[model samples]
Target: MSGPSPAPAASDGITPLQQMVASCSGAILTSLFVTPLDVVKIRLQAQENPFPKGKSFVYCNGLMDHICVCENGNTKAWYKAPSHFNGTMDAFVKIVRHEGIKALWSGLPPTLVMAVPATVIYFTCYDQLCAVLRVRMGDWAQEAPLLAGAIARVGSSTMISPLELIRTKLQSQKQSYRELTDCIRAAVQSEGWLSLWRGLGPTLLRDVPFSAMYWYNYEKSKSWLCERYNTKEPTLAVAFISGAVSGSIASTVTLPFDVVKTRRQLELGELQAKNLSYQVSSSTFSVMSRIVAQGGFGGLFAGFLPRLIRVVPACAVMISTYEFGKAFFRKHNQERLRGPLQTRNT
Candidate 1:
């Protein structure tokens, strides 16, 4: 009888740059995709400034408790919709086109600077903690449902908040802050350092679930694809599918958190000083309740439809491109390995 064939080994062709590009490109694509929705979201969020309609949106809302604007197409905020996407694309393309290859990486520096440490800490902390939990819980380990994903997300996200705060403020309006430095100076001079961490609480809450669901779906989908296809190796297509599923799962759990976070950030001037209420119920329920009390529940979900529409394609493209690039690198590495082997054998 023939001996059983040895099992195929997992491919080690993946590179660090491939991994980073795949991950970061997913994020960048997500930003591009949801940008229009982000603009609408921001306008809706900034209405919290307690200002009357038709005035310039500003950083403050302490002048009043709340201000209501009719949800009509004619609203002044409607005109500003182009600012987010237009400005980002404009900035991104210009930076890439003119700034040599390094320009695409300019905005990326702060992002990576923040994201890398956050990711490292998240994975390390969550894994270490979960390992401890598993040892303690014994049979109850499965019950945890990968709970560490959320915690890890928060752990990493904490480091990323300042960069995100700065990026969002800059992206919200192009001309307002001449450059990143200008945005920082203006936000600090006018809004205070707290402005840099705007909506931090809600952001963590959002990220926790977002990360949890992302990891859960990714692992599940990847396993399913591998098993169902009965293949030793799955392609980048599988990765994108898994990523998209994870993104969808994450978005649902964290969306309301995003809504509240946006509102909080836009109204940073008011929430900064007196957060007694914030400390108590920064939980998701309270955030919804407060928005409803001010503008009704419908107001809370105002831009959700557009958000779903924008996110799906953006995420698909983003995830797909990242996976494709990763696959390309994997193929290149495979060729590299085989080339030397073939030459030596010859």
Candidate 2:
């Protein structure tokens, strides 16, 4: 009766290499899709000084060399009447009309470079850690996803923190650095090597908790949906819905930390651009307190709308594509293994 439960039928989960491949594909696609949203989000969050209506100001939120004008109640870029952005749509239109469509992808190069390795490490580590923790925890395995996700994020974020700093700086000012190496060299020369890791504290504060919540909720939601739908495995739709729900919840809760991180990064970029030696505050709490003091509690939540919009679909598309790729590899591996067995039997 039980010949050992038929030896559990050999699991067909994809290998780590497959996972990395899937994750890389997902990261590239997600970056291309969401860069516009990211650009707009950064612009909104980095704006500290308000450009009053009908006033021209040198607006630099990663894309320098633009005179922001408020004309007809709309913020226009580059030598138009000066005004504040009405909202996200206004910003989008102005950026396109004045800066060109490519402006929306201002940080694409660094983003793509960061995304590939970051996502590969992140997803692969999460998957591996989850498997290990599940087995180790035994009966409490249900909590593995949260822990694994948090740990994975910590590792990946730390590894890619420097790239993230560069990406943020590049996004905040246009053509500030002649090249990537020039940016790194300037920061190192001005602030020492540690400067490259600036804003990492706020980054971890935002990312680790978000990762924990996102994976926990995603797993729970996917499980519930699967049960309701009577499916043994998650479909693309299930993954997408789960990702959107989890991402939105996580992004909202972590929005404050994100705002702080953006501010810190932008300040650093400005300092480096000016070649100024004045160091900005590096403490996460200090930054948060300053934001609160300057703009009330609501200030901590700048760019919430664009962030949510970006994260929801970014999570949805990225996770679904990643899961689909994993599934495809799993099936392929199973067939490949089975072919030899069937041939031997025959």
Please give the RMSD to the true structure for each candidate, in Å: 10.1, 6.8
Candidate 1's residue-wise lDDT over 239-318, tens digit each?
Answer: 66776677766676566776786566544423322222334455557768988998886766665755455544554555
* CA lDDT of every candidate: 0.51, 0.71
User: What TM-score does structure 2 among the candidates reach?
Assistant: 0.76
Cα deviation of 114, candidate 2, in Å: 1.2
| Number of the top-ranking candidate, with TM-score as the measure | 2
Residue 139 miss distance in model 1 (angstroms): 10
